[model samples]
Target: MRSLFKTVLDQTKPVVDEGPRPDDKEAGIVSDDKEAANVSSERPPSSDGDDDSINKDAQPGVQKMEAITKVWSTRDLYLAYFLIWLIYFVDAIQQGMGTILTPYVTSAFQEHSLTATIGVASGIIGGISKLPLAKLIDIWGRPQGYLLTMCCMILGLVLMAASNNVNTYAAAQIFYWVGYNGISYTTTVFIADTSALRNRGLVLAYTSSPYIVTVWITGPLAQSVLNGVGWRWGFGIFAIVTPIVCLPLYFLFAWNERKAVKQGVLVRQKSTRTAWQSINHYFWEFDIICVLLLSAGFTLFLLPFSIFSVQKYGWRDPTTISLIVVGFVLLVFSAFWEKYWAPVKFLPWELLKDRTVCGACVLAAVLFIEYYIWTSYFTSFLQVVLRLEVWQTSYIANIYSIGSCLFSIPVGLAIRHTGRFKWVALYFGVPVTILAIGLLIQFRHEGTNIGWIIFVEIIYAFAGGACVICDQVAIMAAASHQEVAVVIAIEGLFSSIGGGIGGTVAGAIWTGVFPQKLKEYLPAETQDQWATIYGDLTAQISYPVGSATHAAIVAAYDDALRNMFIAATTITIVALVAVTFWRDIKLKDFKQVKGNVI
Candidate 1:
């Protein structure tokens, strides 16, 4: 572990600045560099104080935005990291339980078919929020962002426990994900702020280590909640426990911020702009309008597919047609806005052109698309087909995350050892992903062995660990120290988008095809109950294993999952191709982004 987590301050003398050579741009390869150096060192400065970070134009929050730049002792970081991991630990259990109850929560409204739509809603909302959250932490500082996002998380959990309809549940999911992803984004930024460039991926990968411990416990924990208090309490308990766990971390950041202020390390700079001017300034700065346009466009366009299945008018559904049309228009408008008239660009044109950065972005998007497409409703499938207990189903379902978390340890070590990430991703990640998807496709058949399903999941998890850590490293590599934090915020944006699209597609398939498949597979007498079974997991799993109804339900599930896996498999192949676009940048050092007050 020590080999994996290199000492941050061990080599304090600045890394020799070997900036990318000219041909590196032409090759889209780093040459002596590893990947994306497309990032500019320019940054929006702190409006609050006279600070010495580069790019002094007045804009957002802290100078150099380095929380640890001149802050307190090594003891402070050690305590802060302890508190950070503690938050991660509670967060793991909270999020894990929340995921377990999502399907049931939707089913309470008899809208289980719309389950994926919830993810679509949440992922899109959650995904786009990362940039804004990043901007927020930039402007307001880390502790403030921490408190704000945590509040959102608690609110979402409370609402989830009390939600009575799909609408409320969906909205809660969006809020929850926004906060969830925000917390994740902030922590990653914090890690970058603290760790050296070379060790960034190593530490970032370590963040997922909690999942390794939590994975083994989440299954039994979820099962106990389900059997004892039912699913509502499952979500409710997290809301109650999370604050107790997270508030200490908040106090740590807040107190350190105060100390930094008292010590003159950070001084608040007062803005002279009027309220409206400040609003307008930030409006363009954060690129909110563009985000809204893209979010609306993406949501409207993809959402109709699933809702289309539920609407009685089908192809003639005016609402569905109108949404798709409006969505298309918005999408086009967003493209032109981004290209021509937007005040601030969300991603710079050069970065967009960088194959390494683009490759990483594309990988994030497609990986999520492939994952959400198949995994939504998977728990329901497991319980029905494999006749597994709630705990048993959870263990199987969580294999991917557990495997990824565990594998990340080695992948992190390798990056630390070789100072390279490309070969690991290209050689190990892609092949394993393909194999996992192929196995998934094979196992979706009825009467398939459950072990094969779990096997594929473990493999998928391994791929996720390898691919994810590498892509993130690739993204940050392209950034100058100045632009690194910005890149971190937007890193998961495409993933969120991909997840949203994938979930929508999943809903479309399940709602449109699963019921039909249910009709096709179920016996004549059991036919009318297909709707009931589709809406209720308990109903699906209630019948005797060998009985006609039970077999029919399992067959219907197998059929639906088959389509999902087929779609997921196709997307996985695209990810394999997409990954090739990344230059094989070796992980050598963190961006020292010149011009800061360091």
Candidate 2:
């Protein structure tokens, strides 16, 4: 066995260096001599106490070692960037499909509350998976980690396509979400690895800009599929296409790692320990128990709000109460464990102590909470209340994505040029977001202008795009190179918590208030049909446009949606307050930044 393994390794090793040799001075390649000269000339003199350590860490042989630790040549870097862009383009299409899938999936169940509840559950699963996946990417190398995510997504797509019940559908969602979040987390980390701080925002924006085209294409395509073929085909098709689109990039990554290993830029470490010992080591290093505790705590605490209204005794039910209480207790235990007991901490508590990171987290959480509060049932409202066709609703609903895509590149360029994100967040992002939310509240009524609604969505999208980009840059600037992926994962966790809470709260409001309002506005004679209308959305829109029942149902929808908009606006105000605390740290190269000080 050893001889066979050795033969395979020897064959895979490169026969010669891929770049210019160390002694080739005329080639302009970054050899050992040129690297030292460049470091000395390009790096600014150390002004702070941490500069010496930063300089030492930047030395060629002293960089934090990993399975693939080599810095790429300029040509290779650009090639990697192009490959990443293609990967994100495919990813965006899948996301666009997902946006339409929510309504289709829940419509199968014929329940209003299920939509938001399912979203909360999915968010919880996705959120909890980020930390482990981040660790995996850091430890296992990006190629292996990315392949694992793809496998999960493919399996999930198969499950969803074949699902015959809501339980199966939900299980499929859990797997897909885990893969989606992992992909997103790792992609961002890869971009960070390739680009410096000065150009990071622009690179990220360019990579993400494919969302614009994908949103435009997939929104109509998804609707066409739902209208003609079926939602199952949608999932199955993407499952087949994603691997085909992404496999080339995967092979390229593997090739790069092999070349780096052969070139001596990466050192291969062989493990001598037994298999059982290796498993034990990884389990502790990944802090599996803490992951479980956190996941369970979040799931239990947040899922109840999504279902409490439908429960027999509502909030007073024993199971509901116990779930919340026990969930909170376990959350507290997890916090203490990370702070005091864990041998290897998954969440960098010390980093969280930084003012910028803390503020960014709080702001991001609040923003996501606000965003989801109204969005949880937006497509349903357009379908049931406005009586729009699937295609029409999809076009309008995805305007947010279109607007975001349009503005992201510009915002990224502006931040890159200015080297500042705080002012942009405060003066532009916050006020515009609040204005958009307010406009939505005012215009979200029966007989309101559709054009105005579309405009509001655009405004919100542009502002949200700016805020999200700025927030990401700020957080990245605050973190060191080694911690970039983990910090981003932590930010994702906050967003997930916010999404879970928002979805749960929105579900409660939707399930609790919409039905009561409908009963009040609906005539007593038609009240007997309430169950039919509530159970099946199609039944709600079956009434004629100008009829009493139709008007009453529309009014109920308008009222409930108005309340949701107000809640979102109020929450965003809190986010604005959090943004005020964000410090304006200059976007310096990570190698130059010192000790969590920013």
TM-score of each: 0.89, 0.86
* Lowest summed lDDT window (length 10), candidate 2: 589-598
Worst 10 residues of 1 by lDDT: 41-50
**For candidate 2, what is the TM-score?**
0.86
Provide C-alpha RMSD values for all models, in order.
4.7, 9.4
Please list the C-alpha lDDT of all candidates, in the order they appear.
Answer: 0.74, 0.72
Residue 356 Cα positional deviation in candidate 2, in Å, after optimal superposition: 0.9
Q: On residues 90-113, what C-alpha lDDT tens digit does candidate 2 reach at each position?
A: 877877777777666766777645
- Best model per TM-score: 1
**Which candidate number has the best lDDT?**
1
Cα lDDT of model 1 by residue, 211-256, tens digit: 8778778889887877789877888888898789878877877777
lDDT of 1: 0.74
Q: Global CA lDDT of candidate 2, please?
A: 0.72
